[model samples]
Target: MSFLCLHFTRNIHIHAFYLKFSRILSTQNAYLNRFVVSLRPLNN
Candidate 1:
């Protein structure tokens, strides 16, 4: 029973970590996209 509880808590922690990491990744992607768009005129 204790092992089951530990496993459950670990799953929750991993889920939360993934959510946070994904959010950061999405924001970084947006920033990179904007940066690339800004450079378009210079490249032309």
Candidate 2:
């Protein structure tokens, strides 16, 4: 029925959003890690 179709569509949208967020989060984490490493002194 129409309700079932709507539910399916909503679920797909939420899943896609989560996937995109995860990708962005991973990229952000990598950038932060590099920044942290750069902050450390070479002698340490």
Query: Whose lDDT is greatest here?
Result: 1
How would you encode candidate 1's per-residue C-alpha lDDT over 1-44 as one tens digit per residue? 99999999999999999999999999999999999999999999
Query: Could you give me the TM-score of model 2 versus the true structure?
Result: 0.85
Give all TM-scores, in the order shown: 0.95, 0.85
Candidate 1 Cα outliers beyond 4 Å, as residue runs: none
Clashes of each: 0, 0
Predictions in order: lDDT: 1.00, 0.96
| Candidates' RMSD to native | 0.5, 1.7
Where does model 2 exceed 4 Å of error?
none
